[model samples]
Target: MKTPLSPKSTSGLRGEYAGAGDDFTVEQDWQSYSPEAHDRWRRLYAAQSALAARYAAPQFLEGLAKLDSAGGIPRFDDANRVLQAETRWTLVAVPGFIPDAVFFDHLAHRRFPVTRWLREEHELDYLVEPDVFHDFFGHVPMLLDPRIADFLEMYGRAGEKAMAMGALDMLARIYWYTIEFGLVREEGGLKVFGAGIVSSAGETVYAIEDEAVLRLPFDPERVMRTAYSIDNFQQNYFVLDSLDQLIGSLVGLDFGPIYERWRHEQPLPAGQLQAGETPFKAVRLESLGERTP
Candidate 1:
């Protein structure tokens, strides 16, 4: 029997970020944070960490404990010691979002570009752009899982090829639905592993408990044709049988022809499911129209 999901909250907005690096990385100024800044990190961590303990994937929980992020915002070197040892991955400080090619290159090399700042005291609940907490607290933990790590590198390699094929958008959708907002079925049932959903206190609850939205089984080809918003809660989500399924889906699958076909097909709207789709779990998104903008 599937376990019912518990309630959490949905999320809001994006913002601007500042990175000190010139090309793709910046020196993480470990000593520059103020007492107030640490306090902000503490508040954010205490709340999100509590939620993560309850809702995040088991692997993420394990990684979070290994990193010891509860003290405050983590120094890149401090976390790197454990990450490099575990999965050969490292986090680099960045001002904000980098170019697509640069971002992909980082992943290909097993390096993740983390935005270097924290959200202000007032903006703790939501921010327009990903801050340090969002990047590291939300994403880096999962990088410790070996299979997910390998798949990430493969994703980066595929992304570069997709860019050349003009299927970058198609590929971005894949990243959004999988890496950022994916759900995986476990012994207990559908659990989310995506950073975007895990990081936000609200999205943490909304993604799982709210049955008003579509939670279709993952189909990469179908995902490639879907649209999304950078500033809002996802209109749709895709579920995986397991993270292993995620890696399995891409193994020996070529996108060269998939991109050609996708390029000519009209994009699917963000909030609608395609006809003939069977929901692995029947859910009703009755509150979909009542969401915060």
Candidate 2:
């Protein structure tokens, strides 16, 4: 997902991924955004919020409301003010996609890099890169919860460790399947919690209501080792017993040895679901019962 940095700009930040001929860093002019962009943000915000109430996890709703999500294209400063006061998480603006090392560094320090741009109207429902709406709407609201915030910090620490171990691929799968496309079993039925799912109107319903997608139980080792695709609706979605169960399992586990063992192993494709082989089950998150470790 890395892109060559655009030509050097007067921005203070230096480019990390600029190609040999170019410097990547550029100053983001957040205020210069057009009225059309604001409309796009407002449209997206209103539409998604309506859908999310039905499909999104309850906590997501509460946090979204608490953040006053109705405002169009939130200003990082204003959003950060609220986020900082509530959970100490702040958003940093980045040009576009950043290197994994840089991304990990930001997360480790409780800074989430949000792109300052919004997608065009035609690009609605799908975009290859993370934008302001996706970053703030898709990801930020969850940060309001204490347990979820701690899990994110721990995840950042884990990312740093994984990078040192040369296991970024394995580590990314854990993020993709859990943070981006995860589901949780609720009394009503399966519900959406992953940002990736929340931001997509079609995928939101598909992930939660569709019988086609394979739903699997959450396992740290299995999740870390699994391979996922970003190009399509996930073929497999991992369901957690609860936020507490997910945090407890991963916040304490050592990924170094696990990554070492799984590095050379063949990765399972995004959609492979087998009852005995893949641990794909229909059990509710509450049904996980007691902790294993």
Candidate 3:
């Protein structure tokens, strides 16, 4: 859900404006996708899938297997059949980014908004905005996990509270650090579960193997108080012991007091560690030894 706090003007962005309804949803028009678009998806999937197998969490790998999206850009209707059965979630198509309120409402009800259009050929390596590949290939598999599924619904429900309290920035940080760019400690070593990392081959390896990055244990208050960068690879990534820990940290927890204290305070810089904070030890990639290709 890479949405803006307020709706940006999309007057000239015909890709995002055409056929959108009051709610900003549009028909996926699955058949209209060119063969080239499907080919692009195939290439993106093949490259990322190999990287993911070596560095992704078991839960993510399981979900990816269930998705069976290797062949082409999946029809949302077809993917929904598996998603609805697995987690009672559905994917809705939108032209591009929508307003935060609209985004929260969709998540609150277990509907995910995926962009209807694909990026052009030249933009394959990188794109500033989220496109269909980033939304579906990056995120949808994780939605198959029950913990993640329930956690997101709760996050969506909490949106109004964050907005009313003028704490949307803090909440967005939570989403950015966890859903979009989180890491987790599995039995083998540190592995990525974040969509943002798993979707990019470069980061999929960089996040774990790069000793220069800062990895810290997940802390709700610390996460909310931290700032992040969008233009490049993250300087800091939060690590979860388990998905259960992630859910337990926020379930029925009050954020009012936390927000009141930090809302007026300057956010901690992205890469700088606070005094007394310890960084998680980097995982040794060489020790992993011969992963399946």
Writing each residue's lDDT as its tens digit, candidate 3 over 1-293 gives 55643465575453656467877899999999999999999999999898888899999999989999999999999889999999999999998888888889999999999988988999888777788898888899999999999988988988999989999899988889988899988886899999889888788888898888999999999999998888798999999999888899987778999889999899999888889999987887666765432
Report the alpha-carbon TM-score of model 3 versus the true structure.
0.96
* Comparison by lDDT, 2 against 3, better one: 3
The C-alpha RMSD of each candidate to the native structure, in angstroms, is: 8.4, 6.3, 1.7
Q: Candidate 3's error at 12, in angstroms?
A: 7.2
Candidate 1 off by > 4 Å: 1-22, 282-293
Q: In candidate 1, residue 18 scores what lDDT? A: 34
Cα lDDT tens digits, model 2, 1-293, are 22224233324433223332222223346678788888888899998998887778887888898888576677777778888998899887776666676677677788777766688899897987777788789888888877778777777777767777788888888778777887876664667888899998888878865656678889888787677777778888888878777688876577778988988788877667655755444433334352222
TM-score of each: 0.88, 0.85, 0.96
How does model 2 fare in lDDT? 0.74
Taken over the whole model, the C-alpha lDDT of each candidate is 0.78, 0.74, 0.87
Query: What's the distance in Å from true for residue 80, model 2?
Result: 1.0
lDDT top scorer: 3
Report lDDT (Cα) of residue 260, candidate 1: 92
lDDT of 1 by residue, 77-191 (tens): 9889998999999888876656777778888899888877788888877776778888888888898899888988898888778889888889888888988898877555566
